[model samples]
Target: MELDGQRKSDNVEDVRGRSGSGFGQGNFGRRGIRFPSGGGGRGLSLSTIIILALIYFGLRAMGIDVAQLLDDGSSGSSSYQQQSNASGAEQEMKVFVQRVLASTEDVWTDIFEAHGGQYDMPKLSLYSGQYPSACGTASSATGPFYCPGDRKVYLDTAFFTELSRRFKASGDFAQAYVIAHEVGHHVQNLTGVLPKFNQMRQTMTPAQANKMSVRVELQADCFAGIWGRKADDKGLLSAGDLQEALNAAQQIGDDALQKRAQGYVVPESFNHGTSAQRMKWFKRGFDQARMEACDTFSDPV
Candidate 1:
């Protein structure tokens, strides 16, 4: 990961040391709860959803407006404070994130142009604690996510520490892979894949919808690998960069995560793929470096 001279993306919104929107006003809501809509929301993060679902189940008996909490009425899109006093390693990571985002802009812009499409660079927001996004309130507990409703990627800088320390997938490239994967979801939104999936999921059984979700998330992993391929081609990646990202993909797989959290694997409950499946899809995109190779839906399940 050699990004010494790279240009930083101007699209980054650094809200690290600021108060959240008025939504942060003394509310009953806790920050970063992973609640998904019935038919049209990003799949919840594995561990977060399980924990939140347990709490949600207990609260449902009390007649809480779960729907309002899940959707949050879409505040549309907004950027909070721009000033960040982050210093030391955290500040370095921020600059690195900006550069990686700039790289994605360059790579996707070229790819989109070649395919006769215009690419709109997605906004990236750096936050600490909780921030109100178009999707809902983003908390540090929910990890990094892309909100298709806002066309923005939200990240808590603390997640980088957790990614390396808890997940044991440390490296600059691993962080880039995380950002690229979320941006991949933005690509899905741009190409209308997410809306179509959401529409179809309305008629699907829970298991069926979960399977579709695996495809969606796996495809995003592949898209991250596509960005890795571009970085490799441009001689930006060091020798260990690819393995860092691969290790990250394996670590965050739903199967691996569930096993770690609950000591068992439940395939039916998986929204993201298994460890091998995630690594395989990422490799597919890395090896082929094309969008066609990244199609998880049509591929044999």
Candidate 2:
């Protein structure tokens, strides 16, 4: 991608190196936090408190800060303006992220205006290790996600390294597609699609919810393709850019991930669509460049 003279977004918050806030120490799932249970109650029992203290001390002895895990984000230097001595590569990555975010802001704003609506831009939060979000605590293990509660996209840049090394989806455009997909979720939140899905999922069975989630995720993929279309029109995309994004969609499909992790696959547990479906929807959006063309919910996806 050629971004030499492109604008960079000021809506990015770099919270890397700052102590993260939230309770418990566990990886976050795709879009939700996996908090350890301590039994259901308004207050902890004496035994429970003692057990927790013991665990905390044990972790501390192992050089972990249990207090940081429970930080409410109130007693630290403000993460908003914290300085960092980031390496050259990391600094370049940050600049790339800001430029991609700016592209999304411009593309979405124009698309919304064309439909007689104003786009409400969402902020992007950059953090390493873990960070507090209105929806939950975001960890690197969670990957990149958009929190509807805070209307912001959370990302850990280290995931880009994993994307290249583990997933073999190495390219600047592939990385941009990841950012664009999360931004697509922010668009869904603004359009009421996400809110409705969240409400309906509350009453849905696990299988049913997973089915709906596939459609939601696929739609976001399509939206990312739409952004790709706009970027191409602006001469931002290079020769292999589109292929890079398509390959990324293929690599990160739910079925592919499941197959790699385990020897077998469970069809019912697939929440993000298969490789073919992801590529198809993304291509559809790229070719059509219209929001109506990306509707995965209306038809049999």
**Highest lDDT model number:** 2
Per-model clash counts, in order, read 0, 0
Instruction: Show pairs that collide, candidate 2.
Output: none
What shift in Å separates residue 256 of candidate 1 from its native position after superposition? 0.7
Query: lDDT tens string, model 1, 1-301?
Result: 9999999999898887665665547643445654464434556557666887888887888898777676553443331122232356667878998999999999999989999999999999998888889998888999999998889999998998999999999999999999999999999999999999989999999999999999999999999889999989999999999999999999999989998899999989999899899899888889899999888999964
TM-score of each: 0.78, 0.79
- Stretches of candidate 2 exceeding 4 Å from the true structure: 22-86
Name the top TM-score candidate: 2
Q: Residue 51 in model 1: shift from native, Å?
A: 49
- Relative to the unseen true structure, what is the C-alpha lDDT of residue 209 in candidate 2, on a scale of 0 to 100? 100
Worst 10 residues of 2 by lDDT: 27-36
Estimate, for each residue in 1-301, the C-alpha lDDT of model 2 and write its tens digit.
Answer: 9988899999998877655643345533343234445557456667777887899889999999877777755456664234232455678888999999999999999999999999999999989898899888899999999999989999999999999999999999999999999999999999999999999999999999999999999999999999999999999999999999999999999889988899778999999899889999989889999999989999778
> Where in model 1 is the C-alpha error above 4 Å?
21-86
